[model samples]
Target chain A: MSLPELLRKISPTIWELPVTYKEGMRVPARIIASESLIGGMEAGVFDQAANVACLPGIIDYAWCMPDGHWGYGFPIGGVAAFDPDSGVISPGGIGFDINCGMRLCLTNLTEDEVRPRIRELVDQLFFAIPTGVGCTGFVRCSRSTFRRVIENGSRWCLENGYALPEDLEMTEEGGRFEGADADACSDKAVERGFDQIGTLGSGNHYCEIQVARPENIFDAATARAFGITIPNQVVIMFHCGSRGFGHQVATDYLQTFLKVMTTKYGIKLYDRELACAPFRSPEGQAYFAAMKCAANMGFANRQVILHRIREVFSRLFHRSPRDLGMDMVYDVAHNTAKLEKHIVHGVERELLVHRKGATRAFGPGMTGLPDRYRDSGQPVIIGGSMETGSYLLAGEASAAPTFYTTAHGSGRTLSRHQAKKMVQGRKLLDDMERRGIHVRTDSYGGLAEEAGLAYKDIDVVTRVTEDAGLSRRVAKLVPMGNIKG
Target chain B: MPYRFQDEITTADVAFEAWGDTREELFISCATALLRTMTAAPEQVAHEQKRVIRLKHEELDLLLFSFLQELIFHKDAHRLLLHADSVRIEQRESIFKLVATVSGEPIDAARHRLLVDVKAVTLHRFQVLFRDNQWRAVVELDV
Candidate 1:
């Protein structure tokens, strides 16, 4: 059956596919999107979602967030929870760019203070941070040091003076996954990560400067709690991932899983990319351990980049970061299979929740949140394309139905080739400049591929999210400067 | 006819098709396609740099995957612009082994107008098939 015929709309924002819709499906599939968005979604979105529901030990349902799109195995913005005892773990479900995530920083400066210096700031940021493919960061370490980085995560950065003590408090999992075993990582993975500890690898990865527009503040109290009380408050946001280290880790484990998934575990996969092993098996455990290493590397990578951002601000303004009130708001991972305990069937159970292209949106008072944000839910940083606006949202109790996960970003709606065909980088650059947005990119062609038209409308996505009660909007940020890799 | 590669598929990521008269030629065409994704042509790269990639896999599909992954690894780890100049693939007792010499140079902004950085190769709809005396492969790169 076709996607529209296969899907049954339960609510205006939620659609359902009965388990009987597909022969192998063990549970029903849920797609969270408005009618318009669903109409525009590719058929692969539901196909992949149904494929995930068929996986063994999946609890309740496999959910696709509002921004769901076609992905390799799990649909981008897909969320699934597998029983630790009976379920399986698929690397493709966690995505190749492990811990590809968002980090937001609150600054004391306002839009006025940054507007005049936008060009200079972007240039400085572009120069200070490496971009493009194979670009190296400032943190070059020996193989041993690289091992330490993977094992310790942001703690390594703190010990090495790249991070502050409080940074971990606002970061997910304290920026470290406890079970990370560097030895589980392959030599090639380590070699790729050794020199790229803090670099911003290319292709949609970026560092952006934004301002919290007064008119866009949805919840003043929540905005104040997030350090955005003043209208036009400047903020810094960056999007990056684990770089080659995580890519290699996912690649290496995928190959290993494909080799033994059938013979060792009696598992059959509809897609080769969904190759997996039982969570308790050696292969599964080893991949988890290595995945944790990559996860930690991702945290450390962002931590170092955060430090560089602070440095740029400090140097440019001739003021210490502390004096400038440059503080971290939050850092969240969008791609991960985190071991979390959530109530399943009204029974509390520990399940491995795989959120690919989706962010964990733990509701108010959820464990792991920093003390300052105990009253409010964890901050959800949703980045938009360079030409659009982004958002800072707080988790809602309504997200429990989907394991407390929400859309990670305004999901891409166009292919790079299609985007390039519709827009030219030179014209885009000029347009952004005319709109008072400064952008610095290493490749003009890359810039064209990331044109704002390439992504779903962020406003619509975030509105659907809030209306669906998955998350509550806190503030909206408009870009003033952007640095793309 | 020499193998040819084309970027004709449209998805959120990059996808391309490569075809050749033989598997070896298909592998070469695939490598060229992977490199061309980062830049327009091989002529834009210099031959001052060299990277030797070797891998052994039990399946031909996997061998191609590893071969492309090796090129990406070199690009990320060493900033090399690779163009596989020579490729040799042989099967020994059901094991497919590939060794290739790639010539390139460090990425120079003045010469190399880079494109999207390919993070890894995805197996989504990935295929290598022989049809009507011609070999063809479809690959999607996670950029």
Candidate 2:
């Protein structure tokens, strides 16, 4: 049957593919998208979602978020939970850039205050923060220091005088995951990561300056609770990952799993990229350990970037960072696997949840959230195209069907080459200028590749996530300026 | 007339196909394509300094993968835009060895316009094949 024919509309916002649709599938697959969104969906989305269903120990259904698109193994917006005892862990499910995530920084400055200095601010930010391909950061570390950053994560940042205490509070997992061994990483991984820390690399990674649109605030109480009370409140949002360190870790594991998956674990996969090992096996444990190191490094990476941003604000505004109130609102990882206890069918089960290109949208009262945000649920920051706008959302209890996950962004609708073919870089710059958005980029061609038209509408994507009850909107944020790598 | 690289559209990432009459030339062509992706004009990379890269893998596919990553590492580590002027690949038993002499100058903002940073070479759909007295390889880069 065709992909659309195999899907059964379970609700106005959800669709399902029964296990009967494909052989070897243990559970049915579910997709959270509106009819129109599903209509434009690529066949790869359904194929990958169904393939995930075939993996052993997968509980509930393989999930494809509204921002779904074809990825290496799992769909870019795929989410699945595995039974620790019987399930497996796949690096592809986590992604090449492990722990690639979004961080939102709340500031006291209003849009009006930033608007006048937007261009200069962006220029300052672009130069102050190392960006673009093949760039390094201000923090030059020895090999030992690199290992510590990998092992200790944000704690290393604090010790190095790059992070404040509160920065760790709002970070996911306190910016550290236990069991990370520096030895788990290869020498090559260390070499690649040695100088790239805190630098924003290329392709889709960015630091954007955004303003809260009062007119689009959906949940005022929640927004106010999150300290985004004023209309035109300016904030900074940036997306990046663990850099070359994570890539090497993933490469090292993918190779190991390919050899051991069939020989020792007796597991088989349809795609080689879906390389995996049982969660409890030695190989799996090692990868987990190394993955934690990468995750920690990712946190530290962002923490360092945060330090640079604060410094820029301090210098530009002629005030201390404390006076600027550049506090971290929250950080969320779109790509990761964590062991969480969730009640499945009235029984508490420790499931290994793998969220690739999906955000953790734990509902209110979930453990691990900061005290200030415990009552508001986990904050979900969905980065939209530079031209349209982005959003802040809160997880809903009603989203347990897919293990409390939501869309990461308005996922790509056009290929980079296709985007470049369709949009001219200079024209895009002119257009963004017309929209009153300041852009500072190393490559104008890179800017064209991320034009708003290249992506699905953010409003529609967020509405589907909200309509489906995965996450509810808190406030809409439009960019006033951006720095792209 | 020996070897060239052609870009392919996959999804969000970048992919390319490189071909040559010999495996050594194929490797050089692939690395050139990679350098070109990072900048618009690879020819403008002056041979101000040179670096040697050596890699060994049991399989040719992996050897190429590591070899390209090695070049990218130099570019990122030292901020150099390198071009592989000479490449030699040899197989002994099951393992393959590659030695390349690459030369380029430090990135000059006035002369070179930077593009996407090729983060890592992916194994997704990665292959190296020989057909019709010609060698071809397909690599997808995580940009």
- The per-model lDDT (C-alpha) reads 0.90, 0.87
Model 1, position B139, has a per-residue lDDT of 91
**TM-score of every prediction relative to native:** 0.98, 0.95
The regions of model 1 sitting more than 4 angstroms off are: B1-10
Q: Candidate 2: which pairs clash? A: none
**CAPRI tier of model 1:** medium
Span of 10 residues, lowest total lDDT, candidate 1 chain A: A1-10
- Native-referenced TM-scores of chain A, all candidate models: 0.99, 0.98
DockQ of each: 0.71, 0.57
* CAPRI classification of candidate 2: medium
Scored by lDDT, model 1 comes in at: 0.90
Error of 1 at A271 (Å): 0.3
First chain of candidate 1, TM-score: 0.99
lDDT of 2 by residue, B1-143 (tens): 33333333356778788888888989988888888778876778899999888888898988888888787767766788898899999899988988899999987655677778887777777889998888999887778
> Model 2 off-target regions past 4 Å?
A1-4, B1-9
